[model samples]
Target: MTKETIQKTNPDKIDSILSDYILHDKLHQAVMISAPWGTGKTWYIQKKFIPSFESQHKKTWGVIYVSLFGITNFKELDDIIYHQFLDFYLSKSIHKKIPSKAIRFGETALSIVFANKLGLSSEDEMNKALKLIPQPDHIVYILDDIERSGLNLGELFGYVNNLCEHENSRVILVANESQILGRFNDTHKDKDKNNSVNTENIVTDEEKRIEAYYSAKEKTVGLTIKFQAAPDEVFEQVLNKVVDKREVQNLIRQEKNFILDLFTCSSNNDTETILNLRVLAFIDVTIADLYDSVKQYLDVFGKDNSFNDCLPSMINTAKNKIILDMVRYTALECFKFKMGKNLDGQSFSYLGSSNHYIYFLHIFPFVQRYIKQRIMNQDAVANYLKIVLKEEMVNQRLTKSVFPILNEWWLMNDLKVEKAIEQLEREEIPEGVGPEYIRGMMITLITLRERGFSIPIQHFTDKIIKYLNSMDKISFNNSAFSIVSIFANKDFIDLYNRTMKPVYDYVSQRLLDASLVEYRFLIDLQWDEEFPIKCRNHIASFSSDRRFLSIVSAEKISDKLKNANPGEIWYFCKGIREVYNISNVSDFYRADYETVDLVCKVIRDLIQQYEKHSLNKVKTSNLKMLLNLLDQTREKME
Candidate 1:
């Protein structure tokens, strides 16, 4: 019936039904398309159904659409419909002679002339004006957001009845009927308490209103079509609009069903299916952005040789796994976050059990940051990916060669143990090996030596220390240095006590000293007009160690606060709050609470200095708030 055919597989046959209704020469009543909100009813009517209808019957009928979302009275509705018809008439009568560029001006001039000439100030006058159309019967009027309209239902439906019966116009209404009924029911509840003279047998005012509503609907509406869209189909349509990358598109295509499953089930209820296309588009776009970042990260780290080395034939499989894991994570997290749920910790728990490269790629700290902030820190993502890739590769090498035999040493004979020890010795520890891996190796070797394997544990320890010394300063500072206490060996415990403990302590103090210097510079930069986010993140980079604290002296801070402008003072206070806010939760920042308290006292004196002057109100207020925050931090820490 229409140019764009609905698939025969679609059992609803809604397109055919609507086509028949629209093609009828005379419409006795308006057709209402009803669905729940966010079910893509509006999108279907305007984008798919209308385009097909128009394409099939061009010039035979004119289409006019109006949204009754916020219309509260008759005149607002009249004005919108009047303008649609005016534009239609202008296009047919006057636009033929006017150049395309001047048509806008011509329409504006004609609108003013017609409104004044017709004196169209009321609905009756507007309807009179609308009759000026060459063939009013040829126009098909589509009104959307009917449930959101503030107009009384009877009055609104009466107007529609006039158009259908008298003006001989076809009308289609798109609405969420549930919302309309729910609103009316809520109104009834509110009024039930106000009515004092309700007799038990009498039909009440609420019932009368509802009856009138249905009566008007019965008079005006010929057919009501319940609208339901397939979630998968709608998601496909939305994804096609938002995603252009072929790889991303393919990944989504492959996992479309599974992704939808994760999303529909993310509410933790198996039976609930949340099909919101607006949310779907947003999630697809987020997935594409995250996938692009992953691509760039992988590009920087070169290709994954893990698959090439271990399963040479499954290279494509490995690549797809990486992309798919990212897609799954992005989809689930976007759904959860946008739905106001906490991050799904279960999705990330695999990181603890598996050292798979795929698991490494699915680490979601960067993802959580991106989702919450709406800013992709590509450099940070790439750097973290680089670190994960290195660790995964090293872990793979160790797991394949040495770790298995060492971990299950009882199954290995004397020759196998000797070979494992030799492999451990020959394994030239990489420069940036994570401390966890290093400690694991040290424990295994020391245990083997204690078990009489002649493992040369001290030589291995020295080599590990040498590599730790050679690691880049930033990487070394960021290392987590995981500690395992399960081992009861005197030698391994003694090694940690004698060597590893002091090394980590020295490294921690060195990092703290360096961070204090950087913190001072960041404090000064905070007063500058442009405090870059890169700078802020660099300051927050030390947050995990809990050693991050401002070391600026109270005298210098007082001098800076006195000279700083309002915006500078605002940013400076923000930085101080952000830095000290962490001190509330961290025991490490407790040592610096005295310094913060002194700064608060300095700001108190500054506020007093500016309190008597009207010119320093902004700076004084900022200092006052900063002092309050510092005071709260001190109390919390105490």
Candidate 2:
């Protein structure tokens, strides 16, 4: 027999129970023990009640310890108890009987054997059978972990009462009160003996029982023990246990101190304090994930030989530092390795890595400072100014300054420059900026030709032409309209047709449009003869204009050239160039190598067109200088 560790607040309480049983000859078939988890309810049954009762009496008692874990239905309960009884009565001999169809009936038959042997049988035949069997003075049934049995209190208590009616059994049901009481009330609602006790009655009776138990044990017991953990108690215990472990002690100490300070400074009471303490406990567990990797490293590589092995050097390195700072560099490297993102803005690879060293290094210093400040001063108010400063200095610098330079030098340089430029030209501006804002914008515009609106090109050109006409500038070469046209091809062609056609029609309507300069020039113009004569007349008129001549002489015309609204004449000139450039005829076709030769011809034509007939002789020198400049530009472009 072993002594049970039943907790009694008062020594007189146990004495009263012994007096009731011995002096008054009082007997109880069932007793319910209640307490919270880790509150020693099972300890009381096994260490105090069972051993003491067996030692005090001369008669033998059978003790059954049943754990009701996972006992879902009545069948499970019956099976568990039956198995427990078998173990308890291992020293006793009993007749073996095979079960038939009904399990419940079979269990009832087995229970009768113990009752009959105890002289509890009512029938004469059963009583004769009971006389033949050895009698046990008492049966001590200990149900431990009864909360897992899923039995309602009413059903459980009712079962105990029935067992008591049949056998000389003392039932001890040990369970955590918090897990059982709420469930019991929700499931069972009977007024008769079937109900264990009313909720209010149960509370009052439990208090009285607790009071009696404590009073009986008052003299012998040194002190009543409470197993529930208080916030401060748990904090001190965990901190003491972890602060010297070498591997994780530093981090755990910091976190523990943080939690303690939080509780000390908080206006809330015990419950809220415990909740916050639990949160800090969770953070400690997360920090341990980092520490575990460091431990593994040290274990694989001997600690003495690991990371700056020389004691003097290590001490020098750690000057003006806390213990947590010892592993700060390692932690940071681990975080980065595990959590860094690639240029594609994806995190899959980093998160999948075994070590998150870099991320740890980046975050640990701030976390360390936070813990140190909180613990040293019990600071309830957090300073966000540091966070703001870090965001501006560290994060912003890394993103804006470092990332762009690195991306351009290392990644973008590998891409085709021309292709990249084309991609940019085609890119669309997204509603909001994307992850690769510049690159994605360029690619999107290249894919979709239209800009902000997805309307047809003709509509966009019409809008631009209307805007160009409204501008104040009237000079054809310098107008904002010409710049707009050169930038926008659709607008250039539309405006060119509007401006050039009237000039050609006015000349063609009169016979004066004819001259050897026009007819012999037409043959020399070597226009793609396939075009209608009216189109050729338009081209000639456009070529004859001083503004158009000036633009041709410049070689590099401003974007404004496209916005001139040169009417039919300008469109005719563009059509003639495109047709002749692509044509197969020797005189009409221009070779790629001769583009400079053709550009020189266009400059000479522009000088002839722009110089007034009276000023032509004097402007010849200026024209020769201009031609020389064109020759230089052509050589450079080649």
Candidate 3:
């Protein structure tokens, strides 16, 4: 880059000096630019300096940029240089004269194309130029990744020197000096040829070895510029159009202490990588959502929105959750890109789009423990971080809050909506507000709204029953009912027809199961309008339970479920449906455990043969149902 332009870009102290040296017409020796990775050295030289140097310099006609990153030999290097020149000419639409000996290889399409660029308008001119090919002295060569090439360093240096000294072409070498030359060995201590060698001889030998190591570099390299790009300048250049700068800057200021501590006393290379990525975090929240700025809101905390507008979101793209999954995926990918392994030592790969769900929820808690929890309590998070990062289960339970549930789309399929509802029920409810029934009522209202039907609150259930009865393919069968079930409890009637009689029979049996005596009494008091007060008293008195449930003076069934766990409430809601053997488990007081097992096993076998749903599906659902039934015994819930 020109001195003025580069200075304006970064104001680095070295810009002017380097720009002046590059712009100078003197061509006594080659020049070298040395810098570590991510310093924008290559970018600045290629994008700015070369164009400026060629434009501003008097002697230079064209600049040739060649990266010897993986080139192994002189032949490979020659091919790259030639192709890059042709590309450069193709880009510029310019042609230069070439000597005859170079075109003597003959008249192939390749020769013609290259010969035409060499200013030979006809095949005769190309043949005439073929007998005496001369080096292009007007071209300046920029050889990058000098240390990465597999060619011998001393040999390569000598070649570069020959191009400058004999071919009269200007050369620039780009590399990291420290990376190319590691710490000097104690070769000074080793005697050369004999023990008679003195200290002065040893010193001279060491200097010669260091100089001769580069072979021609001592004489060929006239100027060596260390590329120390300014930090703020680099960030501004890289992130100017990528993100919302003002807002990210504020967030960064808030997190300045943490970021500073993280990279304090770190090596320059390590620090440089982190600085670039910290800039990335604000613009795009990485997998951990550590520095995510996008805010999220849920209909939680007994807010007005909870009842006024309740919609069961099956899939959530809530910004923070997306950031969490995104950052997690990115972190692992970064590791894999660098180290060839994920944090868990499994070599991960993306298969189309399955990666979106892979390890996301499983590792979210760990990410939270490390990146988030520490902000609240260092000690708590410290302990939590240890377990989670080690591939162990998290100490904290996976939160089942409404916000979290919204993002768990994998658990909300038509086959798994019941699990979603159950999980939602597991959240810590706000006091005195029964949101589930409100949710239920909202659901009913929304359905009615969609169907262009309306009913009073008291008449809603009756209307739903009437509507379902009006529809075909449903009825109440005999004592021995066909086993039927729906995936969601709320889908009880609206979702299925064949389940009516089987569900009713199961509910009646479970009510009389004797284990849930108080539960049965409460339901009778709540659901049956004509339920005799005398019968309710008899039922309540039938058990010496601590809580006496009544008919007219009955508490809402929801009140009893207020403190119930998700599993328990799930059981209370769908506890009877399990009798269909689709989601059955041996939690209730049944005839026998063996019989229940045998029944489930038979149903499972039938499912496997015909696989109506799936045996595995039944097993998974049954396990959930069993857990729900078990939790139902723990406490009353709403």
Model 1, span 134-234: residue lDDT tens: 36566688999988988766567778888788777788888987677656533222223674433542334677657645655787887777676766778
566 in model 2: Cα distance from truth in Å? 35
Using all chains and alpha carbons, the TM-scores for the candidates as numbered come to 0.50, 0.30, 0.38
Point to the candidate with the largest lDDT: 1
User: Candidates' lDDT values, in order?
Assistant: 0.62, 0.38, 0.43
Tens digits of per-residue lDDT for model 3, 151-252:
656567778878777776677788876655531222222344674435654324546656544444566777677665555454455444444556544444
- TM-score, candidate 3, is 0.38
Task: Report model 1's TM-score to 2 decimal places.
Answer: 0.50
Per-residue C-alpha lDDT of model 2 across residues 431-544, encoded as one tens digit per residue: 222222322222222223322323233333343334334444322221111111111134423433354343334333322323323334323343233433533454434433
True-vs-predicted CA distance for residue 134, candidate 1, Å = 6.7
Candidate with top TM-score is 1
Better of 1 and 2 by TM-score: 1
